[model samples]
Target: MTLYETIFVRRSVRKYDKTPLDDETLRGIQKILDEAERIDGQTGRFEIVVGSRVKNATAPHYIFAFSEANDGAYANVGYVLQKVDLYLQSIGVGSVWLGAGKPVESAPDYVIMLAFGKTEVPLRSGAQDFRRLVLGEISDGDNAVAQAARLAPSAANSQPWKLHFEDGKVTVRYFGRGLLKAMLKKMNKVDIGIVLRHIEIALLKEGKTVRSVTATAAAGGGDLTAEITYVD
Candidate 1:
């Protein structure tokens, strides 16, 4: 499947071709994005804003993904919108997550923005193109799911997740502390969301379903963000 192939080849594209996406294509993308799996109980919204109002880039459009100001909103936004990112790349559209860009918002709660448009850069050729942590460093075990999670993108390339699988549930644990820990908390959740997206797509490609994902404590008793159970 192209979506599965996109998982391995997609990369953040900053340069755009300046040609705005057509209305049909935009509507199609919006519809596809609306089908994205969101975190349970995490309420959010998405808007397509075009023009020079968005600061810091020249893309033809910006996808403003945000949630009601809350503790885990940013992570939720990251989780949901990455589906759009992958979808766009799979169909030859280019995009980049804009963590630092500011939008002219009517409200003060816009959490994250993605700059998207036409571009000439090709989909990544293979794993060699990804500047990411090795599989062994991120997971205690190896499998198709773990390999997908290993390729998830993270803030500042700080891949904070440590995975360990037992039975059918996969536990995602993190590492950090103090002020740095507090700062990376949101980013870590974003990382988990991204990783989960990878795992979800990987499993779906094999005719399996992710039954449920729940929060739990690590075996040694740390903050395990989630435990996902899948059925084939």
Candidate 2:
């Protein structure tokens, strides 16, 4: 299935077979990580290592993301890695986002990691398999984009984002939640990026071409926002 179709069936796979992937498969995944797009004005780095290099070995491989600490950077990491997550599953590999995971030799800029390997788990049947907020709660309208984007995973399922659609673009704003404001703020930023990818794919599936994607900080340091413009 294409990445767009994979989104509906994908799930966070925690139990993976311990066998390492072939060198060719690992290299192909590395290439995907290297070429994945980022949120504008953000610079993030990625690395693929064996499970032995990570603190928990749920999977045989882990892709670690590193970037400067900030909303845009964190969001960029999510935007890029979510593509890898979808692609891995599209090709029969299983993956899951690891927020609490750490590398044995950590970089100061590390943001998050994705654990992936072969698995026995099955993909979800379709959109019905996802347990998420209704479209009205997360977006302004029940368009196809909102439907697909709502399924994007968040830290602890916080889903802290609000989407505003306009003539030629959609603006994603960070909507903070939970008692731990400090921690949720960071993960929610990543969630914003993940949803952005879903929005882009949904738009493309609707026969729209993305013109540009830009990220910016709200005035007075309020919401962190990313705007995506497209042409029909």
Candidate 3:
């Protein structure tokens, strides 16, 4: 399935077969990690390692994401890795985002990791399988982009984003919730980038060519926002 199609059925796989993937498959994943798109002007790096290299191994492999410590950097990690996450599932490999997982050899800039391996777990049937906010709650336009992006995953399922659509442009605004706002601040930024990827995919599926993707901090650092300008 195409990444766009996989977005509708992808699930966060947890139980993975312990066997490692073939060397060729592992190299393909590494290539995706090296080439995944990031938020404009941000640079993040990813490393694929054996599951034993991770502190809590759930799969036979893990990809450790590293970046500078900032909102844009964290968001860039999400933008880049979400593509890899979708690609893994599209190829019938199981994958999950591990926010709390760690590399056995830690680095100062370690951001997040994704766990993956073979699995007997199945993908969800369709959109009905996702427990996400209604389009009306998270987005202004009840269109294909909104529908697809509504399923973008967030930390603790916080769903901390609102979408606005204008002619040839789409904007994602972050508005975090819950009493753990302070604790989840970084993750929320990452969540915004995850939705940004979904928005781009939806636009592409509709025959739109994205002109640019940009991120900006709200006034007084109150919120985070990303904008995508596109042409048909």
Candidate 4:
């Protein structure tokens, strides 16, 4: 299926069949990851691992995607990981960003995990049924991805992100206020990543491919930024 088709067809699949990713499918996943890393250079700042165990016991049959902390440096791990999630969906795989779970001891800095497998039952809803808002529909141009991003789940639904669009690039700014910042900083970029995932899904639906996506540290009072540049 085309990227847009996958976006429209994809859903947050939780339950999975016993089937694991075949070698061919795993190679395909690697290709997608490679492309995502190429498009977004932040891939080098972290690592991606695969495992059968779900960090949370309640959700077994899950695959893992983890990232190491870079001394709390440019915290765009979430943005990068979310790109991984959307790319997986585009290639006929299902994944859910696993936010709440037991941290792997070997990888304490690893912020997020993704559950993966074949769906036992298809999701009933279509992508069109999924929310995608237009520029004019929003209260401010700076909130380009607000509605769609809001749909992105955060730890306990804190929704700690503010987005801005300028120079044809969508900039995701973190709202690092309240008690949630210090507590959720480890996984905060993960939420931005999920929002970036939603934006990419919307762009693909519009028949455009994201040429590049980048995350940078907040300077002069800005939080992390996720910039999406489109293909012609």
The local lDDT score (0 to 100) that residue 68 gets in candidate 1 is 71
Error of 1 at 1 (Å): 5.3
Between candidates 2 and 4, name the one with more favorable lDDT.
2
RMSD of each: 3.0, 1.2, 1.1, 4.6
Evaluated against the true structure, the overall lDDT of model 4 is 0.57
Task: Please count the clashing residue pairs in each candidate, in the order shown.
Answer: 0, 0, 0, 4
Q: What is candidate 2's CA lDDT for residue 209?
A: 90
Models sorted by lDDT, best on top? 3, 2, 1, 4
Model 2, range 42-154, lDDT digits (tens) per residue? 77988888899998678999988988888888899889999999999999999999888878887888888999999999999999989988888889977888888998988
Using TM-score, rank the candidates from best to worst: 3, 2, 1, 4
- Candidate 4 Cα RMSD after full superposition onto the native fold (Å): 4.6
Question: Stretches of candidate 4 above 4 Å error?
Answer: 38-41, 44-76, 90-92, 103-105, 127-139, 142-153, 176-182, 200-212, 220-222, 229-232
Candidate 3 per-residue C-alpha lDDT over 56-119 given as tens digits, one digit per residue, 9 for 90 to 100: 7989998888898887788888898899999999999999988888788979999888899999
**Candidate 3 error regions (>4 Å):** none
TM-score of each: 0.88, 0.96, 0.97, 0.68
Candidate 4 lDDT for residue 148: 53
Error of 3 at 11 (Å): 0.4
Q: Please state the error at residue 207 of candidate 1 in Å.
A: 2.0
| Per-residue accuracy of model 4 over 46-118 as CA lDDT, tens digit each | 3444442334443333434444454123244555555656666666566776667554444544555666666
TM-score attained by model 3: 0.97
Which pairs, if any, clash in model 1? Answer: none
